[model samples]
Target: MTSLTIPSPGGRLASTVVAMAVRQRAVIGDEVTYVVLDRQWQVVEPVEAYLEYLRQEQYSLNTVRLYAQGLASWWSMLEDGGLDWSRVKVDDLARFKRRLRDRGIDSTVITLRPEQTAASSTVDVGLSSVLGFYRYHAIVTGVPAARQFYEHVMGGTMEARSRYASFLGHLGGGQDRRVIGRRREPKGPPPFLTPQQMKVIKDDAGRLERGTGWCGDLRLRLFWTLLEETGLRLAEALLLRHRDWQPGTGTTAFVEVQPLEDGRRRLRAKNQQHRRVYISDELDDLYGEYLFLLVELGVDVQDDLPVFVNLYRGEFGRPLRPETIYDWIEGFKRRHPLLPSRWTPHWFRHTHATALLLAGVPEHVVQRRLGHRDIHTLMTTYAHVTEDAAMRAAADWKALVARWGATA
Candidate 1:
């Protein structure tokens, strides 16, 4: 690791000004893992330990990489402040939060408010990672300074539930602790594609070839269809295998989203949790058509092979990548002006949930279909849908009351 030092503001001290970086290395037999390097270019032991613990606890590789990046930012902050990692205080963390918020401002420009460089939610993610690092060290190594970052509060108290339990504690009873200076984020609905927009995008993805029944790019078409219909995450859909597709009796079918470890890439399903997402019979027929197209192209299909693979581009038969999907969306948006300005693959998930709620589906049923471990997440995320539903019912209440009066 190469290290560089720059003199501090008043030339009073030389501080490491270089930011830390994350690297991937093969540990055992094609299995890959991530490690963080400090500004001085040495492995950060605490971060390495925490990442390993996450891996052992079955956290996805993408999640591990994300946490590593956050911790890397923390290490850079510590170096910039010339502060020791082990001796950081609550005030230091607050400063760190400010630094993150002001990350992209131009030094030459002078303006109040700093133009809001980073979103509050993004800063919160970084802070959460840093706090989790300290929390791990405090519990495992009994580091006194690390323990100072949190305040233990009794369970069943409002503050405890709202603060401590939300962050680091188990639900429903016991003493818990929350990190100081963790910002409260606003609750809002996630963005989703409208039905007409989804239809246009899917139709544009793959068109039927003239004089032939095959679509131009069946693989890409199938991908958008799967996400739109089933609400699968980008990674979850990418990690799907041929065997995971279960064709039920007489036109019914479902796809099982499993936590498969792909040795080639660090791709895994989010949360490493298993759940089945049912698909429409039309989608089932689409899958079969895609298979037929695969055979025509001389690409062999197998049960263990990834469902979405690169048939038209790099490394035929290799798993489709999340980067490729993002690139596709970028080009797609350029071609189509009707899509939402801030549309994303995640919008399919939001759209799916919103549609279900609006169609009068029970919250719990939607929760199960979406593979949420509990209904709380479902309720919190789609609360806007429920609230809108209530308002509509209130608007129709006069007619409802009149009907009841006449019946009586």
Candidate 2:
């Protein structure tokens, strides 16, 4: 038998074993034995083979982890019911699905601590993961796959997608969808900083430059400036490299994002599209300053190297993670009570969009600059800013009307 042990939360070892008999059956068209925690189960070999296929497909680490976790949970539940995976029928899967749905409903009703709420939504995602496992297993084994199971369990219906979206909306202080098909509650405008508050934030970031012996201060300043100027998402900014910047004349600097982690450097943007952003003279100067600071620190200015690194970490040179930037911004907010309470990285994007709109920039230009795949996303998110612009147009219309009446 080949056995592997994984450490559990309470310092206990969970054992997983594959027997020689199972290996022989796996090679043929028969059942295999898998033992976990001293319990034995006869499952079809395809389940194991399907998992290997998923790994080869290059799914995200979290996705792979969740699917494996789901399978383990399903197996444990089946064992509790005195059933093995090979003997489990469609009726059993249906009953398991019901239990999952009930558990999810209960979780939704329970109030979780602020920190725990994010983890709770995994219940729904876990359900989908388990269903996907079964469907893949059946496909690989040539078993009679459950069509209804795939439809309801794996494919989230429109209603289910809307409900999931609402659940997410609640985390952001929006309304939860009611079960009785009532109209969704109206939501207020998203929180954003005013122009004056934004100015204060910029000033606070500028103060970092005055400190002595801060090796990465210049990079930090550039980070903040790029966030404000380009309005890129924090994740997008973190993935940037020196090669992304183009120094030459008429050509614009571009940012390419990828949905898959492996493709981040090679593929196009998140929407599978590419965008070109004009680098202002100020941004060019900041980039130069960053390069100079890198030279001062005795670091090579390689095109493949990350644009920013943790200055505090000694010469090993670890690239800064996206969450670290958020933590720094939160720390800055705590230090400066005068700054707006609602300030966030997204607020900088909001402020940029608003400032451009107020300055009479066209909607299409703003859309391109923000790298929005859909113009509707730009319109919906910044609708209030557009409304304010609409009011200004109305005021101009009133003036024209009064002037024409007077001339008549």
Candidate 3:
């Protein structure tokens, strides 16, 4: 990766004028952790402390990366305004939100639409991260300003009642405190690919030719099929091992989604939860074909080895990096103008869940299949679809009432 060096402006806070950056480090036992760095490349003690707290609390690496970025942005804002972090107030946070809306961290980023500002979702995430940092400090170090950022209320109070509901309803009618609220983003339907688009991409990846077997990269074909059929995350699919797949002749096969200690990279399934995802017979056959091709290429068929490896690249037996898959997707986007411009592998997952729900599958079953920790998450994510279903039911009721009135 190319590094950009910015000349520090002449100021008392020059040591952090370039703001702060998150740096990754390997701790004891080879576990990777992140820390924030100042312009002088020194570790920011307070930020590191917060990140270490998250690590101890078993937050995933992805979560840590996000929190680290938010803290870094906060640090940069402080540096620009020559304000002390300990003295941050609600007003300062509000100003920071405007700054994010106007220019973001780096305005130099290329975009076709220049009028568009930072997305509300992105701003909300950053705000949440920053607030989380202060909340941590307030509880652990008793920072006065940070403590003042929150106010406690009795559970019976309207404020407390409004804040706690749904899954958190149990906490209502008890002593509760409210933190700073994030910007509310507009809800929309989950983005998914159409069946035709799915077929086009799958064919583009690996198409079987007449008189010949599979013509293109059979491994990628299998990988695409696995993602399309199983709704596995890119990381989960890339981290899959040969033993995870259980194939049977003319019967349904299953793949186990479990965390494993991978030396190539430390990618894990979301929440590191273990679940079995069943695959179609065609997908199982695809897996078998890929395995056969691997053996033909003299690749060892070790059960513990990763199912996807860098076959064409010089690093023959190394596990495929997540970047490799992303690069391939970018290539597909370039070649297929008809495909969604912002298409991603995760689209397959959304499509999978949407298809299931539209087919009259139970919400709880879809929740389990998607490995959602709670039904609420699945419901909230696909609320648009559920709401439409409800409207359809109401329409049916209206039609029945009309028929009864005519009969009467």
Candidate 4:
């Protein structure tokens, strides 16, 4: 048997806690809990260690929750197969994949999670989490079989490599070496709005009013206007303060997306990176009018005031929630029977990416504007845009070559 070693006090402590906790669980008869986790997101063996590792790695709570659920699904499969997780062979992992595909979905059996009818994407996430669990244990808990198992599962041996530009480098932490990541090809381009659908949605937004009332709410208009123009993640827009607007940056205006670190519903961009978003001058003027409207409604027009706020009954000054914005969009969809059932507020983001690509904006520029960590992400998400862009590029090259060939 080969031995594994890690030279870190924190790593050893985490392993010890996880190992002891599971053994104690047998004596305690389930009284020994592994943190207060949602049923579907519960971890099995090494729960504390894995969770602690994620905490140390600075994964967000929401990110931790999804990762936990994926691990929980893997554990459930292991229990059904009656196999020890630590001793998992490649064949066992292959069998798990086959089982998931064969079962498809057992609605009655899968109650805790949404895997009842989960797509291929969900299955892939589960597989990734299981692999990650093995790799982590192999490194931190000194389990040699785990290293062998990780290689077998990967179907290839991994090479150690240097990784510069670490996120926690400033704190003198974060891994300087990382396993080469393996992400399966995306299942498909996400459902997005077409130019026609966007035009329709925009027209509808322009005409929105308070339910059953003749009065037009400027807040309602500004909310949709900001979302459409800036392509903000709903939470980013929801938590926007008046001070975020940095007007007059040489014929354009920019808004700063600040983090909502200390709130019940914490708000951050998907990347958790601060970004500057430019909006049309029209939107800038509209915001000015919206601020005046807020003042008229006896709401404070201060820098700290939320751009979108609850203005009904007792909840008047509270910042609006993403869900509330979604609800309003849903209501709009219902009222306009012509609206596509597949349309969601997020389609605006997709549409924005598509429109930018179609209009010949450089992908990197669009990527930066949208706060995408990778330009490849935008290219993948808007494959249709890229395809068209590719064709146009080919045509331009062909014309240039034809002129040169004729002269030669």
Candidate 5:
């Protein structure tokens, strides 16, 4: 549908079929299968092209899957409503937004999460994805109508017209931008484990008896420690390899974070950059112990093997999945009365970033440590820290003012 055709000398039926075994997987883990297209390139055909475009741009698989789903869902909605793709208007886009905002969304359309609220935050997410799909087609094929709908309706720009114009298609990428800050209330800072709670949890994890058959509590602790110390994303830490870690001067080490680039098995880093994190000897030793446990369990200690693997779950040597840790953490919170029910692996990242900033680490340094591309991103998350610091400074100023008045 997006115009990838290899014309054959033997006519249409004699075309060679490209084996999919060697086809690149979508940056999204699960890529979509190609659908047969009609002579016209409208409707769903562009969806395939748009997905491939995402993969080419190195968009993550999760991102690609969302675009694919959003587009396909919108396409189905269009077909059912007897609407023409080329003829879609700004008002139609509003209708789609309302439909997504309504309760009782068809399970087939979207699988809602507990955290997903109706009408605003979650609905905006869907609208963004769907709008992205249209943007993809507009940018790719330079479709004027699609671009107009995206800019006018979705971007909150001017509306589409009734009569056709003999003008050029979507001319500029900057013509439209996503409308933001319209939420009823902005989200609060990410939750984090308190220092006291972290210690208690670490003690509980440290006291894990390998004999109880969970041999991986120490491994979990190591994972958590890496998050706390390094501020590495959970996925980055999970996909770590033995070779990725480097030993440094007395009681110190560094963990290399690389874009594992090629395989679906070892996905690329979220930020897709190569960086290293300093590690303490204590954590390095914990890592060694975890490795030794893996060896004791007859798991291979190859340099390229994933650092974290299933220890008790029947799938033994397979890389430990996030869901496993999520469930484990949930159960852990249940077992230990001190741990917060809302605490998660990601919270460690927030906790680490906050700790570093409040400890007087420079913003640029914290940004690099957290693998954030922009210092503004770091500033945005920790803005509350800045405000608190300012408030404390104001108190000092007040004290100085009082002293000056007394002297006067």
Candidate 6:
């Protein structure tokens, strides 16, 4: 039996190799072999320490797989330097951070495209995951100095965390060092159709009615109408079921959204709150036509059946994905070729809110309709739309003063 001594927080300690076996078991005939060690100067084989961490933490299988791969890569980097656990130091960890930057691993963007380098956020997250593995090993093995090394090397403190984050920012051409507190720039306003332009779009969508049967045309018509009238999120509109509709007079009606896979009825809403929207008269008519069309298609007008179905048959026929609405909007853009590139489905929600605010609806009411939890959200996001109203009020006040002076 060969004995290996590693430095621990307590002091230098000796471990003996007990047995050798491969870390992973082969699915088919045989498993890989690797040596395992015991605490005494005797060799003993034990299960991989990282797997124990996953089991103890109750990590999901996917998470375990990711962590295992990341740890393996980190261990390989350490081995390339001929450094074992006891030999690892803060400077070594710093070098690893640089290597990650060199490899272009980014955490911010889910998928990287050509010419897209890893963003600072992305690198930090990946490094953090790798750091977690070392931290876990230190705790489990009862290595005395291991914990201190990890803290100085990878602890989530302002200084330790900043070293890696700053390196990432430098890589990305920025000066930001703090990782968690940084705020992303606010997205520009949602592009919306003006009242006149919406009339044009609706009319264009209506034109599709002539070629397609009434049943097919109803889907596009109602989809557009709901977007224009309700300010519902695209997913919310697509997830609507028959039971969600209420046809009573002067009463509020709404569609309930359930979680769906893909963009089609996917549960990825802004805040995960179930929104109940009042159907506008125009939307009600569209919904009526949709119901009639559903009956004609021999599709039961029951709650279980998807309210919206794919016009073309394929896997997509499950229900309309949010992208489908955007695709249609894109098609509309192509047909017109005159609309601005910024125009999108979200623009309809913004347009709806802006129009209501311009018509003297209360800011709070607009907030509720838009599912904004705070009134400030409406005021801040749509401040530009209210500027004209403010200007008109100022002009009206001046006119009233002039009239009073003349009368006196």
Give the number of the best model, judged by lDDT.
1
lDDT of 3 by residue, 194-286 (tens): 666877888988999989888878898888878777778888898899999988655558888886544336576786788888776677878
Worst 10 residues of 5 by lDDT: 399-408
Clashes of 6: 22
Instruction: For residues 1-408, write the lDDT of model 1, one tens digit per residue.
Output: 335566679976675644545443546777777788865567988788887777777776666776777787778767766888888777777677776788734344788665757877677677777866766666666677676554321112233333222223342136444444455677667876666687778887886777876555778889888887787877788888899998757745888889677645667776567877767667888888888888887778889888888877788877787778888889888898667767888898887777767666678777877778899999988888877855444233333223211111
lDDT of 2 by residue, 137-233 (tens): 4444544444334434333222333222221123223232212121224655555555456546655655333555333356777787776666676
TM-score of candidate 5 to 2 decimals: 0.73
**Which lDDT tens digits does candidate 5 get at residues 95-206?**
6665555532443455545334365755555566666666665656778888777666546543344332211122223354544322445778767666656666676665
Q: After superposition, which runs of candidate 3 have C-alpha atoms over 4 Å from their true positions? A: 1-30, 104-116, 152-181, 249-251, 260-266, 386-408
Question: Which of the numbered candidates is closest to the native, going by highest TM-score?
Answer: 1
Candidate 3: deviation at residue 245, Å?
Answer: 0.8
Clash pairs detected, candidate 5: 27-61, 28-61
Model 4: per-residue Cα lDDT over 185-287, one tens digit each: 5566655555456545655555435674314556776776676566677677877888998765575677898755323444545667788887766677777
Of candidates 5 and 2, the better by lDDT: 5
Q: Write the per-residue lDDT of candidate 6 for residues 190-222, one digit (tens) a residue.
A: 455665676677777664445664533567777
Query: What would the C-alpha RMSD of candidate 4 be, to one decimal place?
Result: 12.4
Clashing pairs in 2: none
> 1 or 5, which is superior by TM-score?
1
Model 1 C-alpha lDDT versus the unseen true structure = 0.70
Candidate number with the higher lDDT (1 or 4): 1
Clashing pairs in 4: none
Q: Which scores higher on TM-score, 2 or 4? A: 4
Q: 319, model 5: CA deviation in Å?
A: 1.2
Runs in model 4 deviating more than 4 A are 1-45, 79-83, 98-117, 158-216, 248-251, 259-263, 298-305, 386-408
lDDT of 2 at 154: 33
